[model samples]
Structures are given as structure tokens and as C-alpha cells.
Target: MSFLQPIALLGIALAATPILIHLLNLMRHRRESWAAMMFLIKAKENSSRMSKIRRWLTLLFRTLAICALSILLSRPMASDESSLINFSNQKPEVLMLVIDRSSSMQKKFLGSSKTLLRRGLEEFEQFSKSWPESKLVVIETVFSETVILDEIETLFSREMEDFFGPTDSGGNLPFTINKGLNWLEDAEIGHVQILVISDQQESNWKIRENEQLIRNIKDKIDSKEGLWKLRFLKLESAEINNFSLVCKTYREETDKFHPTLLITGNQKNTQSLAVKINVNGKLSNLKCRFFPPSTTWTPAISLSDQPPKGWIKISLPEDSFSKDNDYFFTYGNQEMLKVGIACKDEHTRKFITAVCNLDPERIFLNETFSLKSKKLKENDLLMIQGFSSPEEDSQILKFIKAGGRVVNFPDFDGNNKPQTFQNWNAIESASKNDFFQISEWNRNQGIFANTANGRELALPYLKILQRKIPKEGETLAFYKDGESFFRRKTIGQGVVYSFSTLPNRDWSNLGEGFVLVPLLIRIFDESSESPALKLLECGESASLEYNELTPITGNPNQKPSVNAGIYKELGKFFAFNRKTSESQDEMLNQEEMKKTMSSNHILWSEARANSLSFERAEIWNLFLIIMLLFLLGEGLLGLPAANFSFGAKRQ
Candidate 1:
């Protein structure tokens, strides 16, 4: 049991008023002696006692009424396990508000500029103003973790101005809700109410995959046994006809730059949208027509004459959501790398050159060395197909430290086995007739971007007669037998890659198939673009190897740089936009929400909800009813004498 207004309990002293009045009346009365009065006093002694009992009964009813009224005025809230005697006054309530400040909450109505977040904050301000005595703690859903904005004491001090500011990040409701519940547990307060305010986005609240987590949270609240209250304020939605540029993939085709864009629209009727592009500082526009449940438009932009190397900007017409309308891309002209291959056999040298796919002028074989000046250059990529002695190893290590990429293929020459190399040891080979299949590869990385079309990569059928493993490098691809086939090592500013087997028909089938061409091309492309360019979402942070990034727009001191634009550091360009997942329009309906939450939790629509509707166990009306019943009992007990007098007169 708890009291919302405990000061009214002082009225309980009025219960003694009836007893004081009765005692004072007894003292004020003086006994007048008379012959007839003395005789009647003795005979009617039993009657006097009965009349005193009736008076005492009336006084008891009046005192009980006063006590009930006092409790009613105190606004006591009692649980099912609580009684009047068990009521306490120390359970001060802490109102914790978890609000969603993501950009998805910026959807506004058709005729008004007010958004869901704006209206929801207005309703929350009104509700919080009504509870000036309660301590408020506010947590906003952020990109990293749940951020505590306003502490409990600040709300009590009447210093709150804005409930939530504009944000560029998307909401993460599950993380924030769990954080609030944990804070309540640590606080150990008697009365707590968690008020969640959001538009009920499925991207925010759908945790069907985390069923056990949801069950655990439900059990925690039930363990409190009515000490905690969970309530939700669901915001309403209006008409939405939003179009967004999901993403764009840029590539070099022939001597020109080619770009393909993926655009998604969510609307009821067909709409015309203007698409703008700035390629190599040349501006152009394309008109797109879309109709939807979900409609995707794929448009290709091709440059006939090779445009000058520069940045590209794609944009869409602004609507209710302006965060996802723009995109940025950077392109560079191909600079053929000078590559050299050191191999003992002619077949291996030709195979390496075929995989590289570079022009003949830039591709050279080290086996045809005719002079001492024909050694590997510092800026050239060196593919070593065989190893000779410790002196050769020393020269390769020195070349790697000078900012060069080294792709080493295992060598099995006369008297020098693969295990003779330092820092590496080769065990006995597996069954000779058995095959090795790639089991795992990094998907998020661009190296294997086109490797997998489904759940698994359709790799070439290859059988390995010999395999060598590295001792110091991260494995990028693994075989079915849990052996590494490809590994990467970093030395100074350069990188080294070790391929367990050479791309030869005698050792493996990977050389005879179609996987070697693009794989080699991508490696060259990735090597040329050292420290690859990334397109990040707005809420994420960037860590660069060089401190040369300058903000072209927006404040650099402000984290996350909510404004979408292009940033340049040194000669490289980066693109940042709002989180792509926020473009989804899926939401949970009322019945779905009911199934997702526990029975102890309550949900209300912010469109028609108020603060007083969720008050705990309102017993003031019950106390008023009890007071009226006691009043009726007092009147009925005092009426017995009148009935007896009427009966005697009638007789």
C-alpha cells in the first residue's frame, strides 16, 4: 500500500472528537436529587446502561467514518495483499520516461508541419506538468547505448525545458527499455512507473528472435509483485508517401565510370519523383515513376567519354523525411600497377600473368632476369612462386616493409620443402585423392563481395594434393577440414598474403577455373586503394589512420554530424547518410503488441491517453463508499427508540 498525498492523514486526529465531546458532556452534567428521580434512577439502571451502549455504538460509527474519510483524502493506493493497517507513507514514486528520438519519428501529418515526435513531446510535457511532486528520470534511445538525459532530481527541481532534441540516429528500443528496467532494480524504490513513448516501430520493438530475453524481463517485473508499473504511450501515424535512395554501387566500366542506384518508394498511388545526379561536376536529372506496396527502381547512369576523376552526388526530391534523400560517391581513373612475378617454371609465370589481367607493358617476369638491376622495385607488387634460402627471405621481408604487397605461393623444389621456411611448419599432407572445399569467408568485406550468391559460395571444384599453413597471419578463408587456405599479414605499412597452394593444374583446380580472374583483379584494386573508402551511416563514428579529415559542412565538434554530406581527408572522400534501416515503414499493430508484452504491462494510445488513467489501485472511491455505509448504520441504530415509542403509544 502507498499514499499519493500522505499529508491528509493528519485528519485522523479528528477520530477522537466524538469521544472528547461525550466525556465533556458527562462532566458538564450535574445530578439533581429528587424522591421520584432517585427511585426511577435505581429501577431504570439497566435501561440507562442500554441507552449508553446505543450512544457508544453511534460514537464508534462516527469515529470510523472520520478515519475512512481521512484515508480517502490521503489518496492511498492499496494492492490486493494490502489492508488499511499495512499502508505506509515512504514509497516515493520515480517516473522514468524512455523516449525515441530517432529520425523516423519525424513523420508529420498531411496538412501540418508537426511531427510525431513533436506532438508526443507536447503530450508528455502536459502529463509531466501534472505530476510536479514526482521525481523524473529520462532516457533517450541513442546509437551507442541508452543515454540518460535528465536525472530524477532535476525533474523535481523544475528545470526541464525540452524533453528530446532532434536526432539523426534510428531508435533502438530494446536496449533502452532493458537499461531503464535495470536502473529501477538498482534504485530499489518502492513505487516505480516506466512510461515508454514511441510510434511502435517494429524495427524498434520486435524481439521475437529474443524470446528468452523478453520472458526474463517479464519475470523481473512479476517478482516485484505490483511494486513496478509498465505503461506505453503509442503515437499515431498519418499518410506517408516517402521515397528514398537506398544505396548506390559504383564501378569502372571500360575507360568510363558507371553507377547503378537502388531506390525504394512507399506510397499508395503512382507518383513522379525527380532524381538528380552530379557526376564529375556535370549535373543531370532523371524522372522516375513509382507505385507501391514496395517499389524498387534501378536506374543506370553511364558516361560515354571518360569523365574527369572526381566525386558524384545523387539526390531525390525532399518529402516528409529529408534525411535519406542524398548520397555521395567518389571515383578514380585506373593507374596500371607495375607487377613482377618470380617463378622457377614458365607455366607458373604465364599463369600468374594471366590472372593479373594487366597490360603487357606493366607485367614482367623475374625468371628472365638478365642483369643485376632487374630486381623487384619498391612500388611494384611481387608474387613469389618459390623460395631459395634465408638470404632470399631477408630480401622479401625488406621489400614488404617498404610499402609493397607480397602474394607468396608455396614452393616445393629440390631439397627445399615448404616446412623449411622460418616461422612456418608444414605437417604431413591429407589423403591425396580427397577434395578441399571452402567453408567460410568474410562477407562484409569487399574481397568476396561477388563470391556468394546464396547461403554458400559456389567455389570451383578443387582437389588438393599438397597444402601448407602459415604461422603468423589472420585467416581470411578456411577449408572444410578447418585448414586455412588464404591468410593475411601486416608488416609496417605494407600487407602480405599467403596462398597455401599455387594456381596450377598439378596442385589444385583453382587455377583452371573462372575464380582466378576477378579475385586477382580485386586484390590489385584493393591494394591500390590503401585504407579503403567506406560509406558510413550518420550515427556511426569514423577512425582514420591520418588526422586529415575536414568537415565540408556541419560542425565537426558535434558528434555524428547529423547533416548528410561529403567529407575529405588527404585525397580520399567518404560519404555519410542517415541509417538505411530507418527507411522501413513496418510497425506493430495493437493485437501484435498485446501478444508481445506481459499481462502486467499496459499500453495506451497517446492520441487519447492521459496521466491519471494509469494511477495504481485507486481506493479513494472505495473509502467514500465505506463512509456512506457507516453513516446509514449510525442513523438506523439511533432510530430504534423512536420505533419503540411509536409502538407503546399505539398499544
Candidate 2:
């Protein structure tokens, strides 16, 4: 047992004076007698002893109340003293808070109340304020890892303020928690209290070791006089349904644009869902039935018409928390992705150059010499006109991964291998229509105005190269006829587009004028511009605006194994990750994460129940104390009550 203020014991010394005075009065009255009232004195004598006993009991009760009140004021408590210190107002205490800041937290599940974080943070803040001068250490966990946010003994310190920011929204949250536990070994204090505030979605990570580790930590803290607290907040959407346009891709192989969308319907109806989309300001409604009942849906919508400044949105009905419902993504400007065609044949070079439209500077036609792969920046999109198999080239794969598009056009002069895609019989018989060519009407009626009477444009396709494409997702476009005319597949976290046909009209006339510009532009520019905070997609990732993490093993020139993941080497691309990828793997995009997270957003208040584990013994001990007090009271009054009953019966 310990008290916040031990000096309050002086009150106990003062309590003794009253009891001493009462004893003196009783002794002085023992020899006093008056003969004038013998009969009256005899009558009062019987009740006098009873009255004195009652007075003593009343005084004792009053004294007990004063002592109890004083102790409560001093805040006496029993807890571990593992973290002892010599500082003023400081007892032994350890408090650890685990905060989840994954991208999903972007959803305001707390209604218009407090945010998940705001609620936990406020509890800690208020507790610290009351304690005033006590030690506090904080650890932030996301995706099974922990970052020591800050530690302080003073309530509102600068370190505490600086440490508050967006949570890490990533893969396998248990790992983040494990990281936090391991890092906590550095705590300079002894007694510790572990508090976890999150959605409690670790069932998928139900490893026995993890479960045991959590219990072990709690037992240590409890044994040493520390507390364990857990506040779980469910992330089910309550008042709002949101739709996000995650990402767009261009399969240079197929010469098509594929856009992915993530929709969440947390409405009263858990059956079916529907959503509407807007592309470059053009609107269309899409519906999903409970025939495939699901709470969340990920759908890919293809655009037939190439909107110059591609703007797209997927939206559900708006709610008071409007940031999540409707999302906007701008397809980067519709411009030709410059291509460098390397071939020795002049005719093949000219044909490939004519198939694209960009500033003359973006076009490189050559029967020329070698180019250093590294210097080939910005306009790195390349097409090998000759029938060369780049299957062995990992560098080309890296190019596509970096967002640079690539197209391989076979040479018509007999040097190129057309058979690499598929048989010619397949190309001769296939469905040739634009993305909007559903229900017989060409969706690009206005955009393809120049070629209303002509056949569909030529999109070079190829049989998917297995090694070049990672097994991340599905293959969106396939071959036409026999040999694959055009195909799009993701490669090593990059995109690869392949075309099996030549660029000249010798194969197809779709390469005519305006269609060529839009087609070429679609393949080169795969993503949208800087979008509003609310328009971010689910698996789509936005990186920090500043350098935070970097890789060492891959980039040869950089220094090895940095202690803190920060450095100039982190370059510019570190702040991007997809919370919406099909795999649900975590990405590290914290730069643009919001900092002004507030509490008035979470619904459940922690002033009620915020405990991780409860010891049965402590509770039973409290009950035993109350029972013992009851028995002592009975013993103190047992004789008097018996005598009163006997006297009443005789009367």
C-alpha cells in the first residue's frame, strides 16, 4: 500500500488528542457523587453506562470516516514498485500506450464523436495532468511494429507534442505490436502499465507465441505493481459508406488503361451494394447485388474514351463524415509517353515513330549506337522494333516497375518474331471493340469521331511472359485471335505492356491519326496527379512529402544498414504504399498523413471500462475485507443488543 502524499500522516497524530480527552473525562467522573438526588441518580445510573457506550461507538465511527477520507484524498493504491525513483510526487509507475495508425483509421468509425486515437490520448493526458509530476513513456504500434513516440515526467512536454502523428497503416499489425514489446525493454523505469488501443483485429494473427508474450509482459508489470489496460475500438463503418478510386494502370503490351476502385458499404443493408463513377466528368452508375453478398467490394472500371486530364471518382451517399464516401483521382495529363525505338531497320523505325504523338523531343528513331540505361531517365519508355525476346532482361522489368511504360513492336521486315505471341489464326478471329463497346454502341462515339466507319484500332498484344510478370494480380487483357495481339501484366511491383503486332498499316489501320495519340498517351501515363486527402484510394498509397525511410541492400552506392530509417538516400519515392492492394500488404506512406487528429471523433468513452486483464484475487480480497468489517461491527454490539431484548421482554 502506497499514498500519493505520505505527509498526510500528520493527520493521524492529530486524531489521538480527541480520544485522550474522552478517556480523561471518564476517569475524572469515576469518584463524583451527589446525595440530594439519590432516587433520580439511581434511575439515571442504569442508562448512563449504555449512553457512554453509545457515545464511544459514535466517536469511533466519526474518527474512522475522517481517516478514510484523508486516505482516499492521498490516493493510496497497491501496484508494482518495479520502477522506483527519488523524484518528488513520484511513486513507482510505468504506463505504455499502443496506438494503431493504419490507413484504415482513415475511416471515422467513432461517428462524430472522438477518433480512435483521440480517445486514448485524452485519457493518458488527463491522467498525467492529475499526477502532475510522474514519469510517462509512449510507444506507437502499427503493422506489428513500434516506435517510441516520446517519454516524459512532466505533463505537457514538447517531446510529447512532437511525437503525435498519423499511425502506421500496414500489414500484419501483430508484428508491429511485437516490435513495441521488444523495444520497451529500454524503459529506464521499473513498474509498467501496458495499454493497447486499437480495433482488436488480431484473430488472423492468432499465434500462440504472441498470445503468450502479451500475458508474460502483463504478469511482470502486475507482479512489480503495474497495471494493464486495453481499449478496443471496432472499425466497422457506422454512419457512412465510402468509395475510393485507388489506382490506374497502362498495359503497354495491350495499350489499354485499367483503373481499380475500392467501395465500402457500411449501411443498414448488409446485403448488396451499388456505386456510381465519374471519368473526366462523365458519370455512370454501377450496381452490385447480394447475389454476391459482401460488405466491401473491389471493382475495376475501364474507360473507352481517353479523357485528356483523366478525372475519375467512385462515390457513395455522403454522411456527416464526408471525407471517406466520395473519392477523386486525376489521371495524369493525357500526353504521349516518349518511346525510344532501337532497331537497325529504317522502315521499322519510321513506322514505330509515326504510331506515337508527343513533342518531337520525346520521339527517338534510330539505326544507332548504344545508350546507357541509367542516363535514360524521364522519357524512359522504350520499344524494341525488331523481334527480340527481352525475356532475359531484368532491367526492362525494373523500368516498368518504376512507372515507365514499355511496348515491343515486331519488325515487319522478317527479322522480328511474330510467332512469340500466338498463332495467326487467333488474330484473324476475335472481338475487336473499345472498352465502352458494350451493348453494340461504341462507347467512344465522340472521341473516335475521326474513325467512325473504320475497324477498331490496332493494339499490339502478346502471350503473357510469365517471368516478366509478378504473381501479384490477374492478367486484365489477353491475346486476340491466335497470337496475343496486346496484353497487360504487372511485373516486379511495376507494369509491363506487350504488343505482338507491327505498328504500320501492314497489320491494321487503327494506327491512323488521333487514335494513335490517345492510345499512346494511355500506355505512358498510368497514375493520377496529387489528389485531395479524401480522394485517396484504399490500396492506393500516398507517400510522405519528405524523406523518412530508405533501402540499402538494393542501391549499391548508398551506405549500408542505417540505424534510423531516415537519410537523403530515402530519395523521393519512400512515402508511397497501397492499403488497397489485393494482397493487403502494408505500405509506408506517412509524409502526407494528417497530423491534426482530434478526439471529438471517437464514440465509446474510456472513462467507463479500459482494462486489459483483471486479477481475481484482488477482487476477492476486497470482498473479504468488507465481510470482516461486518463481523467486527456485530461483535462490538452483540452484548448490548442481547441485554436490550431481554429487558424489553421482562417489561
Candidate 3:
């Protein structure tokens, strides 16, 4: 038993007050030895013992009443299954079950072979059986669709198996619950008991991001306080040792293709594991080690140039979750990178062309055309100085969506009215004898990142004499004055990188080629290689523009949007992997749950990985009834003895 208001239990001390008052009454009286009193005392002596028994009974009832009142105020709850059965005498009209069926639910329970989703389903099945009269309604996370089961036995039918099966997608608890609430209002459900079963993964809940939705749910539940009851069954266990693998980036060389992999885990000590590498049907193994205190490991694999266009599959030994253990990748035919220049300034165009032709063997300067030309789609990377009209903006945006990278510099002609992307503000000139210097940049994983051998770039030493500020985007590098030096925005499968200053001596020291060469070369390589191979999150394949997608690995019948594997569409292969957010280990704690729910009347319980049955039901009403009965008994026992005497004189 648990008390919602445990502090009220302190009132139980008031029960002793009845005994204290009775003793005080006895002390107030003194024995009188008068002869007239002796006769009356002797006449009542035979019935005095019976009167003493009645007085004690009345005191007992008063003490019980006080104790019952204290317990009632405390709001005691019964947690066992049997106790729940007796407490829920008044059954609900509807039993609504909300289940979280994300990939994390497939994790095994501690010390048990069954997964959290399996345990939750068994518990809900038993609960539905307990309330046979109530209609059963289920809301699953994958689709957030409500399924009404007319017969409780149909829950285990073959038709329902697919609905409860595992999914590769992540769960959205707030959205699913909101959908359930809307259904309740639309169906006009009365007297509902909502049971939410989940592992309470924090990423799935997104409590902070969905505050307004939670508030709306609280308001609707508050309006139907008596008609609705909310219960949460949290399935949780200690963090298990697990590893996740992903393909961060890959580079193509003359003789081989190198694929860079990132491995992350929760182990506290150094460990080594073998990874299986499959290159176009040929399998091989490689070993990698992870050091303590650092949970990330990056390993690169080299494949010969024999098969220019094929696929690669990297797999790790199964750990806690098998879904994230394997990563898929595909490569396409190699070709020279095409660079497009769209600038009105002669110096800027020559400078960019010089940079692109530095490695003439691998780079090709296709053309210097206007932004409105259809040839924009023919190049892999576009260097644009300004947008002259909305048509140019639409053409550039279309190029970006079709997997073309763009680098935008301030307009020398001062025409900056781009409709799709961020536009540049007026150019700002530096003060005399001072220049703008870069202070911070994201060097972890962007074009400004460290060199291949892990050497930092010379961005801190670069200075700018004049610059323009981008309106808005993700700022990758910041200037000393807190202005954006470099910003990036993602569109479709491609990216646009905006630089505040030009690459000439008049603008800044970027003409020295220290930062300009590597930055432009990296963007060029990324644009040339990234489009040939694509890595997407699960459930995102449905948005592909291809008319048909055929599975290349895993179950051939499973749709690419519902599973992780390699699929071919329009002669190109795309790899689908689980969302990185599912690998997070954080969960909702008790304090967070209380603050988000904001209702003390709700009942919640936690179930261990092995232990099965758990439920909470408020028994405060039972205590209230007991208290009333005790008070009634006390009143009857406190009445005078003459009230029970017969009316003999009237007869």
C-alpha cells in the first residue's frame, strides 16, 4: 500500500484523544460515602458491569473513526492485482491502451528473455480479461491509429499480429496520446480508464518540446476528472552494454574507395570486437578496439576499384539491439567532378575557377553560366555570387534538391532578393587598422573540420576587411564580433554553404589560399560523392521520388519505409538505417513525470523486468465508508440505557 498524501498519517495520533477524555472524566468524580448514596450504589451495582462494557465499546468505535479519517485523508492505494480486482467494483465503460512500439521496445528485459513490449502486451491482455464488460481500444505508436477490438479474444488473433509487431521507426508519445484524446472527444467516450504502457524513453516522450500538447491534454482530462482515470505502466531496467554503428563519411580514391565508420557504445572499459564487411557479396572480417572513457570509435575500410558501382554491408556482433548493429552503403560509377561558376565579378570567377582547376585530373570547370540556365543541374557544385530574380532562386533551389551543393558569396552588384534561401544583408566595412577575425567554428564534422590526418585548420588566423551577414541558418563558424562567418542549410539530400566574405585581397586574407583551398576542395569532393550513395533514416524512404523501389537485402516483401536495408530505385541504391535518436539511453524520471502530468489523482506503477503483475487503485473511498460506519456505531453505543427500555406503563 502507498499513500498519495503520506503526511496526513500523522493525524492518527488523534485516536488517543478518546481514551484521554474518558480517563479525565473518571478522575473528576470522587467516591461519596453518604447513607442515601449507599442505597443507590447498591441498587445499580448489578448492571454497572454491563454499563462499563458499553462505554468501552463506544470508546473503541471513536478511536477507529479517527484512524479511518486519517487514512482516508492520506489517500491510501492498493498495488497488488487481487487488491485492484476488489477495488474496481465499478467498472469503466471503456479501456483504452496506448502502447509504445518503437525499436527500443525490442530490448530484452533485465534477467528475462521477454522484451518490454511483450511483457506490456501480456499485462494488458490480463487486464482486459479482468474487465470483460469494458470495450478495449488500442493506440499503437507506429501509425498512431486506433483499433477497437469488439471481442477481447481477438487481441491475439492472426489479424492483429502485424499491428503489434516490432517497427524500425521511433515513437512519438505526446503525439500518440494527443491522438487518443482527440478520439475520445470525437467518439464521446464516457467513463474511460486509459492505460499507457511504455519503456518511457526520453526521446520518445519529448516532454520539453511538447509542453503545449501536454497542457492541452491536462486540461481535457481535468474537465473529465471523474469520468476518466490515467494509469502508466513503466517498463524499465538498468542500462545495458550496447554498441551502435553508423557510416559517417566515405571517400573515393584512384585505386580504392575508403568508407569511414563510427561506433558508439556505453561500455566503461576498453573492448575489442570483430566487424563483418561485405563488399558486393564477398565477406571479410576486421577487428577494432574501443578505449575507456570514450564511447566513439571511427574505423575506415578500403575496397578495391574492381567493382566501381556496388554495395557494402558492415555488421557488428549482436549486442542489446540487433536493429542498429548493421549499416548499409552503396557506391556508384566514378566520374570527374563538374564545377559551375555563376558570378558577375571577373576576379571572383577567375579565383573560383583557379581553385577548381588546381587538381585538373579530378576536377572539371564545366561552364560559367547565368543562375537561370537549365545547365545548372548538369554540374555537381555551383558557386553563385548573387540572385538576380525569383526565377534564378527557383532554379538554384531545384538544383540543390536534386543533390547539388552550392556556395553563396555576397553580391557585388547588390541584388539580393532570393525567395527560397537566406539573403545577404548590406556589406559592412571594417574600421581602419582593424579586421574581423574568426573566433569559433564547428571543426568536428563539416568542411571546416580538421584535415584527414587530424590537423586543425588555419581558420583562426584568417582576417576579413569587409563582410555581409546572412539572414538566418545554422551558423558553423562565427566572427570575433559574434557575426556569422560561415552558415549552412540542408535542402533535400544536398547542402548550401554561405560565406560572409569574398576570396580576394580586397575582401580579406582568404586570397592567400590557406582556408580557401581546403574549404572549396572538401565541398567539391562532398558534392561529387554524396549523391552517388545515400543514407537515410527509416520510414523516410516513402518520400523518395522514384516510382518503384525493389528490396536488395533483408526480407524482399518488406517495404523500405518500414525496415532497414538496401533498396534499388531508378538504377540507384539507397540504404535505410534506424534513427540515431533511438540509440539514446535517457528515460523519464519520476520528478519529470509528475511535473509533466500535473495531476495527483493519477495512479502509476513500475514493473521490474522479471516481475509481471502490478497495478494501483485508490482505496480512499473504502476508508471513508469505514469511518462513517465507525461513527454510527459510536452514536448507538453512546445513547442512554433508558432509550432501550420498554414502555411498560402504557401497556
The top-ranked prediction according to lDDT is: 3
Model 1 scores a TM of: 0.57
Cα lDDT tens digits for candidate 3, 88-162: 445678899998887788887657778788878877875665455788999988667899988766666756655
Deviation from native of the Cα of residue 260 in model 3, angstroms? 2.2
Model 1: colliding residue pairs: none
* Local accuracy of candidate 1 as per-residue lDDT tens digits, 1-651: 556788999999999999999899999999887778867877678778988888989999999999999989999775432456865423437767777876677777324567776666665554444344667777777632333435433432432322355555666676677777887777776776667778877766535333555666667767877767666777766776567776533556545555544566676687777888777557889887765643345555656564455566778998767667777766663455656677765566788877665545434334443212335453457767765555666666666666667777776543334322224445336565566667676542445543322223345355666666665565777778766777777675566877776677666666774555655666665565433354555543332232245655455633333445566767666555566667666776667656756565444445543232233466799899999988988888788563245556898
Q: TM-score for every candidate vs. truth?
A: 0.57, 0.41, 0.62
Those runs of model 2 whose alpha carbons end farther than 4 Å from true positions after fitting are 1-10, 19-92, 106-112, 125-133, 142-168, 202-256, 262-578, 581-651
Decreasing TM-score order of the candidates:
3, 1, 2
After superposition on all CA atoms, what RMSD does each candidate show versus the true structure? 10.1, 16.4, 10.8
Model 2 scores a C-alpha lDDT of: 0.40
lDDT of 3 at 560: 52
Tens digits of per-residue lDDT for model 2, 1-651: 445575775565655665787789888875657777787877678688887787677567545544544544554544222111422333335455565544444344444355544544555654443333444656543223333424433323534432343322333434444455555555544444444555444322323224455454434334433233323333332344433223333221122334433343334454444567766557777774522212334455565666433445566545444434444443433333345666544654665566553445434433242334443334546655444444524445556555554555444443322322221222221233421111111222212111322345433321122111111222232333222334455443344455444434445443454344555555443422212211222222223322233432123322111111112231221212223322222222222111211122112222323331221112234424544564466356544543355566898
lDDT of 1: 0.62
lDDT of the candidates, in the order given: 0.62, 0.40, 0.75
